[model samples]
Target: MGEKRLNERVLSPEEFVSGYQYITEYLKAGLPLCDVLKRALKYFEDQFVDSYCTIMLLNSKGTEFVNGAAYSLPDDMLEKFMHIRLFDGLGTCGTAAVRGELMVSPNVHNDRTWRSFANVVKPYGLKSCWSVPVFKPGTSDIVAIFAVYSKYSRYPTQRELDTLSAYNELLGLIVSNYKIDDSGEIEQLDLNEDDNLNSKTLYVESIKTGLKNGEIYPYYQPVLKSDGQELHGVEALARWEHPEKGLVPPIDFVDHAEEYDFIDWLDEVICRRACEDMKKLMDDTGKTFTLSVNISAVHIRKQNFAQRIEDILDETGFPADCLAIEITETSLIDNLTEVAVTFQQLKNLGVKIAIDDFGTTYSSLNYLKYLPVDTIKLDKTFIHDVDKSPIDRRICKTIIQLGSDLELDVVAEGVECDQHLSIIQDFGCNIYQGYYFSKPLTLEGWKNYLEQF
Candidate 1:
């Protein structure tokens, strides 16, 4: 059979009614606006196969779109739509928002407005785009833009447009009824909050303030050679020095940052600070040390992510070759292809890539084959019990051997005790990072520690 035509598949009335109920129930239950939009887009995409949908909410100033939620679009593509101006001849969504009308581009290639974004969407095989401006309830003011993209080059049928228009109204109601806070938390216009919820909201706001005030900073954890205890590198761990709390651990704020989609900002701050500090340390000590920094998956998914790293390097005078980006195993598996592309981009700049918390995720081995990873920091779980558990010992041995076969450096984490170090040494893993050697230290503490070393 030939390929299915885009116009032939119309959203049925039953499907529309079911989706409407589902989305309304989510809103009534006080779900996050982004989550609700995702569900709605997923429902629509399910109805129209090979299609993707996105909802871009207008910023408070109504100058640009922000906080976009897309069902199938990659983060990089969705990012391009963020902060897009409300202007005609800009793109489907932008033009729709500007004109407050439905904008259709049967073929993006032939459309003049799509020229700016053609290169970005082309790689994803998105050929057709139809966008509708979602207005605030009982007002002509556009609060959001709901866009549909298809792989095929064909205009949406009248039935399809009608279905989209109905969904657009539903989106308007959802967008107008809720307000997204600075922390990305969605709250209804007239919703009551519990004490715990209020506490969480306060903490999230504190994190935002901490970032601006420079309370959130990097703490260095030494990575040493297991054989000779010689410092091989240092991993930059985020630490918050709150005035009232004294010192707040990442356990308290990192998850909250990720939850609120502010991790990217936090990650950049840590990366930049780490680079600047490391540069000074290197210059003062007259020695070069590898600086490894943990990057959240949320930050890595941004468009031109590597370029951002390069910008930091250029600004701080940190050599790319001496920097290693440590990404957790789970992060790599979430979007392997896109992450691999990012890894390669980093590699091109001579920055090393290491799979942090390796062996925690099932797809660790699979990722090694595809990713241009330079090091494998075996998860602490395997090393913590390697001395007591025979299974863990064997797994550690296998990972070290696998790393050897792949010619990649294997760093054993949680080598706190002599027994843990001995076992990993026997397994032929050389790099070590854990509390037995040194805990993550403050900037001044790191300087003192280095002087003592």
Candidate 2:
């Protein structure tokens, strides 16, 4: 149906009631949340052709918006919407979440609200959008956003508004009601809380303050060449030196920053610090050395991710080849295509890419073959018991051989004693990290350690 027909025809009362009743039946039948959303989208799309639909809901902690359901959107667009912080004038749904109001952009190309976001939606031919904030029944607080999009630029008609109201009603019911699985067990709808719940809430707030106050910083851990006891590089690890809590481990706050969706800021801060240290090493010793920094998937998914890194490198005058980006295997799952593109850009810029905690993800080895990676940092699990367990030793040996065949450098992580170090070296892995070499240390400590080498 074209926009003209969509504007003229009001949905029949019987058809609207049946659509809602079908959703209620689907819920009662214990369908999965995504299934119900898919059904709802199909129901709406059958009436409004050539249009797309989306459902965005706040995470339990109210820190970010995640895709509850999306129909007819491409991977790049979906990836762009994966994590949105509820802030003013972010985008259609983000702004709706921030204000708890309906947002209508009849012409995204010319709409003032879409001025900052045209680049994200223009490529998809998304010309118009109308979104309503989904609120809990008894409160003004938004629980989710119900949005509809048109391929052609035009305002939503009165008939479309009525259909939207119908969809919103059904969606609100789904959001507020308890959900059950096919196996007759209750399923928790939201998974945004930390282990300590409210304490985590307070802790996360403290992390925000800590970030602004310069309390979160990068701690350098030395990585050594197993053959010569020479300094190879240092991995930049984030350290939270909380005033009252003493030295807080990464485990305590990394997740909180990620959960709050500002972990990118932490990543950026550490990258800048590592680059500064890289410049320092170059200036003091007149020697260029690698400075490895871990980058979150949050940074990799951006279309302009490489440009952002380039800007940093330009500011610090750090050679791109001297910087290595460490990403965990788990980050490879969701945004593989986007990450590959970003990696290629970085590689072209002379940055080395390393996969950290290598074998931990349920990912295919094909990524190892096709992705632009320079090194593999074997997960500590394989190295931990290589001296005692034959299985562990064999695994480490195979990984080393695989890296060799691929012409990729291999770093065996968690080499704490002669036993672990000896086994890894015997397996043909010459690069190693962990306490056997040195623990993560402050800048001064790292400088002293470097002096010894």
lDDT of each: 0.80, 0.73
lDDT of 2 by residue, 114-170 (tens): 676777788888898888787654344566777788888877767667566545534
Q: By summed lDDT, which 10 consecutive residues of candidate 1 come out lowest?
A: 1-10
> How much is the lDDT of residue 357 in candidate 2?
89
lDDT of 1 by residue, 146-165 (tens): 88899999777666665665
Error of 1 at 141 (Å): 16
Q: Supply candidate 2's per-residue lDDT for 60.
A: 59
Cα deviation in Å at residue 86, candidate 1?
Answer: 8.8
Estimate candidate 2's alpha-carbon lDDT, on a 0 to 1 scale.
0.73
TM-score of each: 0.63, 0.61
CA error at residue 381 for candidate 2, angstroms = 0.6
Off by over 4 Å in 1: 1-196, 226-228
Give me the displacement of residue 420 in model 2, in angstroms: 1.2
